[model samples]
Target: MTKSIEAMWKEGFVNEACLTAPKINDLYNRKSQNIVDKFKDMFDINIKAVIAGSLIMLIMMSFIGAPFLGIYIFCLLIPLIIIAKMELKKSVNLSKGQSSYDYLMNFNCWLESSIETYSGYYKVFYPLFFLGMAVQGIVSQAGGKLISLLVEVLPTDIIILGQPYYLVVAVVIVTLIFARSAEAIYRWDLNIVYGRQFKKLAELIADMEELRK
Candidate 1:
């Protein structure tokens, strides 16, 4: 039964490829195939959101003495991650063969379903995410100040090796590196997926061009 399902999927893919082959070729030859812009915009939005939220959290942590702020940020992030995965799946499905019109419809349907499914959770999630960042900033600042005070009391020798100021600096540097790395990974994954889809589209176009000749 699994084999049959696989075969059916392959057959559908082939049929869709054949049907869209000419259109795909035309789109490619137009010298304005800037579909990457669309994908880039989507990625940019997510990056901006994450960065902005993280900065807010950092500020809050600096001022407050609450670890719960970090927890709240994590909680809000969970739903965003879920939404992102859903969007990725929809994009993959659309790239596979669905027409833009159909893809839009399907995407909207999925979005609606997701909203309904997570409505109750989001009501709590968004506010917490925002509040958490505020709290995190406060806590982080407080933590930094506390460490500075501790360092001040330590022997000058110990201060040279592992001062609280140094620790705080290290943490900031590490956080920035991690954020950049995460963005890079996301971009790489997106490029790999888009490259494969484009290659397949190109092959279909070549076949259609040959047939036309």
Candidate 2:
């Protein structure tokens, strides 16, 4: 009778584990999906906003594109566009069901990486664009006006081998400042969009781990 009772107890524990595993998995899936869905939606909104803003920028550039080097810089941006596409695909995969903590962990890393890469790209993109505008002006038949203007504005004493050292220094300094500011702004915008959702995911991971304990 004791042996039969032990056998029954063993079967009951196995059944309990079988039932509990799916329940825990379902909980993880449902909670993770809720957070992931929200994050994806937020990213989509940012993308739309960015696209609209970029169109406006391109429209403004078109005013000078034909007359300047803007078109070349714009053309060079194909790689950045490709990177964005790859990141979008990565996000699409991220939206799939994941019942383990590893999913959230992967997501956390991806979020940081995405924000850094996207922001850093724009830092390079913006300066190249502004510099391209200068090159564009110089290459255009009407471009002498810009060089003359720079010479007229910069101090005469700051000349280096007939070129204005002060102007070069000023442009470099300004571009660096602009690049840093663009990076900061991009980082802030991303944080604004996805920060809350990321925090929620972290919380979910913490809670789920605690329950496991």
Query: Which stretches of candidate 2 lie above 4 Å from their native place?
Result: 1-27, 63-73, 94-100, 130-164, 178-185
Candidate 1's displacement at residue 38, Å, is 2.5
Please provide, for model 2 over 1-213, each residue's C-alpha lDDT reduced to its tens digit, 9 standing for 90 to 100: 344644443343334344425655566667877787788787666566555555555666778546234345546465566667677678777645443566776777787787777887888877777666655555565666666787777647666544478756766777777677888766676668667776788788786665544
**Per-candidate local distance difference test:** 0.50, 0.65
Model 1 TM-score, 2 decimals = 0.35
TM, every model: 0.35, 0.63
Worst 10 residues of 2 by lDDT: 8-17
114-210 in candidate 1: lDDT tens per residue?
Answer: 4454454554554444444433443566756776676677524434224444554555565555444554544465457555644544454454344
